[model samples]
Target: MRNPLADKVVNIKPSGIRKFFDVVSEMQDAISLGVGEPDFDTPWHIRDEGIYSLEKGRTFYTSNAGLKDLKIEICNYLNRSQGIDYHYNNEVIVTVGGSEAIDIALRAMIDGGEEVLIPQPSYVSYEPCTILANAVPVIIELKAENEFRLMPEELLEAITEKTKILILPFPNNPTGAIMEREDLEKIAKIVIEKDLFVISDEIYAELTYKEKHISIASLPGMKERTILINGFSKAYAMTGWRLGYACGPKEIMEQMIKIHQFAIMCAPTTSQYAAVEALKNGDADVAQMREAYNQRRRYLLHSFKEMGVECFEPFGAFYVFPSIKEFGMTSEEFANRFLQEEKVAVVPGTAFGDCGEGFLRISYAYSLENLKVAIGRLKNFVDKLRKEQGR
Candidate 1:
C-alpha cells in the first residue's frame, strides 16, 4: 500500500524538543526544564473569563479572523507595550497559537522554491514551517560572541534573488538573545535594500530583562514589510489556552486569514474571550511572572558559574544557554548522561539547531526550590565526571 502523505510532510523531522521530552517523561523522579512553559498557572481572572464565556454558551466558531473585541484588545496591547500598531479591522488575525500564525504567514507569503532566511539556535518551528510551505529555509548561524544575535552582515551574506522572507526569532528561544533598536536598524536597512519581508516572532516580547523589547515592525518603513507574531502563552501564563495572533499589512493579513480560515476555521472561541480579558487585565500577572523568572535566572547563572559551566548570560526569555564543551561530550550525550546521573532534564542545545551543539538550554521556569535541587544534582554530576576523567 502506498503511503499517502505529501513529500514535504514526510521529509520533516519531529520537533527535537518533543523527542527528548518523551524520553524524560518515562523517567521516574526526573526534574524537567526541557519544556518551555511557565510554571505558573493562568491567572484566576483570565480563567474566570473563559468559564464565564462557556456558561453563556459562547462555544460556536468565531469569525475566521477572530472576534473584533479580541483583535481590538490585541492592537491596543501591542501599541501600548511594544509600540507596534495594527489596524484591528484589517491587519490582525487571531490563530490557535503563535505556531499557527507562523504556519499561516509562511503559507501565505512563500511560493514554492522561494527562500526564507532563518537565524539558527532559534525556535525549531521556523525552518520546518518554511519547508512545509515549500520554501527553502536558509539557515544563518548566529555567533555566541554576539550573544547569538543575528548580525546584519550575516543576514546580508545569506540574501539571494530567491529570498522572500526573513524569520526574526529575536528575544530568542534557547539563547534568549534580543535585538534592540540599534541592532534592528542595521537589519532593517538590509531588509529595505534587499526588499525582503519579515516574520518577526515576538512571543517573548514581555520577558526581556535588560531593555524593553523593540518590535521590528515599529521601525520606520518596516510595518508594511513585517508580520508581527505574539500571544498570551508566555506573557499571560496561558499556554494551554492556545491563543495567538499575527499582524501585518492588510494585503498579507488577508492572505494569511484565508489560510487560517480554511485550515483552522477559527481559533478557539472560549480562548478568544479569555484572551480579551488577558490583554485588558493581565499586565500585573506578566510583571509578577517576569520578576519570578528573573530571580530564577540570576540563581541559575550563579550556580552555573560556581559549577564552572561556561554560559552566555541571557538578557531575555527564561532559558540559559550554557556551553558544555569542557565536559568532552556532544550536547545530546551530555543531556542523556546528565539525565541518567542526576535525573534532571535539560534540553540538548543541538535540539534547537546545528549551531547549538556543545551547549545546553536550561529553562528557569521552575520554582526556586526545584532549581536549587537541580543545581545540586548538576554539581554532583560535574564533579563525578571530573573525577572520572581526572580533570
Candidate 2:
C-alpha cells in the first residue's frame, strides 16, 4: 500500500496533556491536575435549556452562522461585558468549540505560507492548527518575568514581511497569565503599524480574578482586525456542550462562515440554545464559579509558598505555572516522579512549548478538598527531592 498520510498531518505532535491523562487514568488513586477542564458541572438552568430545546423538536440544523437567538445573545454579552459591538448577522459564527474557531480562523486567513505569530506556553492547539493551515508557525517565547504575557518588543522582534496574524491567547491556559488593558493598548498600536491581524482566543475570559477581562477587539482600530474567540466552557462549566463562537469583521466572518458551513453544516443546535441561556442568565453562575476558582488559586499560591516551591501568583483562569527549575530536573521528569511517588498528575509546561521546559502546569479547578490533598502530596514530594539532593 502507498503511504496514505499527509506528512503535515502525520508530523504534528499529539497533545502531551492527553498522553499523561491516559496514564493517570489507569493508575489507581491518582489525582490529575493535567487537564484544564472545569470541575463544575454545567449549571442546571443551562442543562435544562438544552433539554427543553430537544423536547420542543428543535433538533434541526441552524443556519451556517448559528441560531439567530444565540448569535444575538453572544453579541449582547460581548457588548455588555467588553464594550465590543458586533453584528450577529455578518460578524458571528457558532463553532463546535473554541478549538474549531481557532482552526478555521487560521484556515481562512492563511493563503499558503503567511507567518502566524503564536505566543508560547499557550494552549496546545494553536501550533498544530497553524501547521495544518499551511502557514509558518513562528513561536514568540514569552518570559516568566512578564507574567507570560506577550510583550510588544517580542511581537515587533518576530515580525517580517510574511507575518500576518498573531494568536493572542490570554487569561491563558496552563500559565493563567492575562494581558491587561494598558498592555494590550501598546501591542495594538504595534499591530496597526505593522499591518497585521490577530486571533484573540479569550476562552477563559470570564475566569479573570484580579482585573476585568478586556477584549482587544474593543480597542480603537482593533474591532476590524481582531478575531475574538470565546465560549461557555470555562466560565459556565459547559465543556461537554462543545459550543463556542467567533466574531470579527464582516469580510473575515463571511469566509469563516463559509468554511464552517460546508465542513460542519452548523454547530450543535441544542448546544447553541443552551449557550443562549448561558449568556442570558449565566452571569451569576460564572461569578460564583470564578469565586470558587479564585479561592483555590489563592490556596495553591499559599501552599507553594509554604513549601518553598517557586510559583507566580496567577490572576486569571484556573491553572498555575510553578517553576520546577530549582529541582534540577526537567518539568517532565519532576512531573513523572511526582506522579509515581505521590499519586498526583500534573502537566509539564513544555507540553505547551519548548520554553516551558522548567515549569509545570497545575489546574485548581478541583474542589478545595482535592486541592488540599494534592498540595500535601506536592509538599511531601518536594521535601523528598530536597533531602535526596542534600539541600
Candidate 3:
C-alpha cells in the first residue's frame, strides 16, 4: 500500500504554544499562564442577542459574505474608532475567526513562491499559513532593545523582488509589542516604496493599556494596500462564537470572499448576530475588561521587578516576555523545570520564534488571585536558581 499525505501539511509544524497547554490540561494542581485567551465571560448583551436570534429561528446561512447589518456595523465601528471608511458591500468579509481570515487572506494573495515578510515573536499561524499558501516565509527577528517594535531598517533589510506581503501582528502575542503611529509611518513608507502589501492582524487592538491602537489602514494610501483583520474574540470574550471579519481593497476582498464562499459558505449565523450587538453596544463591557487586564498587567510587571526578573514593560495585550538569560538555561529547560518543581506552567519564548530563546511568555489573562499565586511560585523558583549560581 502506498502512503498518501500532502507533503506540505506534513512538513508544517504544530503550534509550539500548545505543547505546554496540552500537558497542563491533565496535570493535577498545575497552574497555567500559557494560553493567550481572555478569562472574562462573553458580555451578557452579546450573548442575549445570540439567544434572541435562536429564538427567532434565524438558523440559516447568511449571504456568502455576511449579514448586511453586521458588515455595516463593522464599517461604522472602524470609521468611528480609527477614522477609516469601508464599503460594506465589497470591502468586508466575515470569517470563522481571525485565524481563518489569516489563512484565507494568504491563500487569496499568494501565487506560489512569493515571499511573505513575517516579523518574529508573533502569533504562530503566520508562518504555517504562508507555507500552505505555497509562499516562502521570511522572518524579521524583532529586538527587545527596540521594545520589540519593527524598525524601518529591518523591513528594508528583509525585502526582495519576490517579497509580496508583510504580516503585521501588532499588540503582538507572547511579546505584547505594539507598533505606534510613528513606527507605522516609517514602515508604510517602506512598504509603499517597495510596492508591498500587508495583512495587519489587530485581534488585540482593544486591549492596549498605554494608548489607542492606530490602524495602518488609516494611514494615507495604506487602506488600499492592507488587509485589516480583527474579531470579537479578545475584546468581547467571544472566542467560542467563532466570528471575525476582514476589510481591504475590493479586488483583494473579492478574491478572499470567493475563497470563503466555497470553503466556509459563511461564518456562524448566531455568532454574526451576536457580533452585531457587540459592535453596537459592547464598548462599555470592553472598557471594563480592558481595565481589569490593565490592572493584571501592572501587577505582573511589578512582581517581576521585585523578584529581580528582567522583563521589559509591555503596554499592550495580556502577556509579558521576560529574559531568563541570566539563569544559564535555555527557555525550554527553565520552563519545564519550573512547571515540574513549582507546578506553574509558562510558555518558553522560543515557541514564538528562535529569537525568543532565553525568555518566557507569561500570560496575565487569569484572575488576580491566580496570578498572585503563580508569581509567588515563580519568585521561589528564581531565588532557588540564583542561590545555586552562588549569586
Candidate 4:
C-alpha cells in the first residue's frame, strides 16, 4: 500500500527543538534550559476571570474574529505599550496563539512559490509555516557581530522580484535580539522602497532589558504595510492557554479572517476571557516576571562569561545563544553529550536554522536556583572536556 500523506506534509522535517526534548523527557534529573517558556504562573486575577467565565457558562464560540471587548482591550494594550494603533473592529483578529496568527498571515499573503524573507536563528515556526503555505522561505543569516540583528543591506540583498513578504522575527526567539528604533528606520526605508509587507512577530516585546522594544509598525509609513503578531504567551506567562492576536490592514486581515473562519472558526472562548483580564490587569505581573528574568539573564550571562563561553549579549526574551565552536563538536554533539554526561538539556543552535550551527540556545526561564545548578554543572562539563583534551 502507498503512503497517504501529501507531498508537502511528508517533505517537512519534524521540529529539531522537539526531537531532543523528547529524549530529554525520558532522562532522570535532567535540568532542561532548552524550552523557551516563562516559569511564572498566570496571574491570579486572570485565572480568576477564566474560572468565572466557565462558571457563567461562557463556553460558547466567540465571534470568528474573537470577542469585541477582547479586541478593544488588545488595541488599548498595544497603543499604551508599543505606541501602535489599530482599529478593533477591522484591524485585529484573535487566533489560537501566535502560531496560528503566523500561519494565517503567511497563507493570506503568499501565493505558491512566492519568496518570504526570514532572518535566520529565528523562531522555528516561520520557515515551516512558509513551506506549508506553499511559499519559498529565503533565509538571511544575522551575524553575531551585529548582535544578531538584520541589517538593511542584508535585507536588501535577500530581496528579489519574487519576494512578497518579510517575516521580521525580532525581539527574537532563541537569540533574544531586539530591533530598536534606529534599526527599524533602516528596515522601514527598505520596506517602503521595495513595497514589501512585513509580518512582525513581537511576542517578546514586553521582555526587553536595557532598551524598550520598537515595533516595526510604529515606524513612519510602516503600520499600513506591517502585520503585527503578538500574544499572551511569553509576556503574560500564558503559553498553555494558546491565545494570540494579529493586527494589520483591513484588506489583509479580512483575508486572514476568512482563512481562520473556515479552518478554526474562533480561538478558544476561555482563553479569550483570560486574555482580556491579562490585558487589563497583567501589567504588574509582567513587570514582576520581567524583573526575575532580567536577574536570571544576568546570572546566566555572567556564568557563561566566567566559563569562557563566547556569546552575544541578549537584550530581549529569556534565551542566550552561545557559540559552542570552542568545544570542537557540532552543536548536536555538544548538546547530546552535555545531556547524557551532565544531565543538562539545552537546544542546539542548528534547531533554529542552518546559520545556527556551532551554537546552543539556553533559556533563562528557569528559577535562579535552577539556573545556578545548571550553570555549575555546565562549568564542570566544560572543564572535563578541556582536561580530556589535555588543553
Model 3 score (lDDT): 0.94
Looking at model 2, report the run of 10 residues with the lowest lDDT sum: 308-317
lDDT of model 4, residue 132: 96
Q: For model 4, how does the per-residue alpha-carbon lDDT over 1-391 read when each residue is reduced to its tens digit?
A: 9988899888887888887778888998888888888888888899999999999999999999999999999999889987888999999999999999999999998899899999999999999899999999999999999999999999999999999899999898889999888899999999999989999999999999989888999888999999999999999999999999999999999999999999999999999999999999888899999999999999888888898989889999999999989879999999999999999999999999989999999999999999999999999999999998898
Model 3 agreement with the true structure over 191-307: per-residue lDDT tens digits:
999999999999999989889999999999899999999999898999899999999999999999989989999999999999999999999999999999999999998998998
Show where candidate 4 strays beyond 4 Å.
none
Full-model lDDT, candidate 4: 0.93
lDDT of 1 by residue, 1-391 (tens): 9988888888887887887788889999988889899999999999999999999999998899999999999999988976877889999999999999999999999899999999999999988899889899999999899999999899989999999999999899989888989999999999999999999999999999898999989999999999999998998889999999999999999899888878889999999999999999998899999999999999988998988989888999899999989978999999999988889999999888999999999888889998998999999999999998998
Best by lDDT: 3
Deviation (Å) of 125 in candidate 2: 0.5
User: How do the residues 1-391 of candidate 2 rate in per-residue lDDT, one tens digit apiece?
Assistant: 9998899999988999998899999999999988888899999999999999999999998889999999999989999999988898999999999999999999999989899999999899999999999999999999999889899999999999999999999989889999999999999999999999999999999999999999999999999999999987888998899999999999999899888988899999999999989999999999999999999999899999999988887889999999999989998899999999999999999999999999999999898998899999998999999999999
Error of 3 at 323 (Å): 0.8
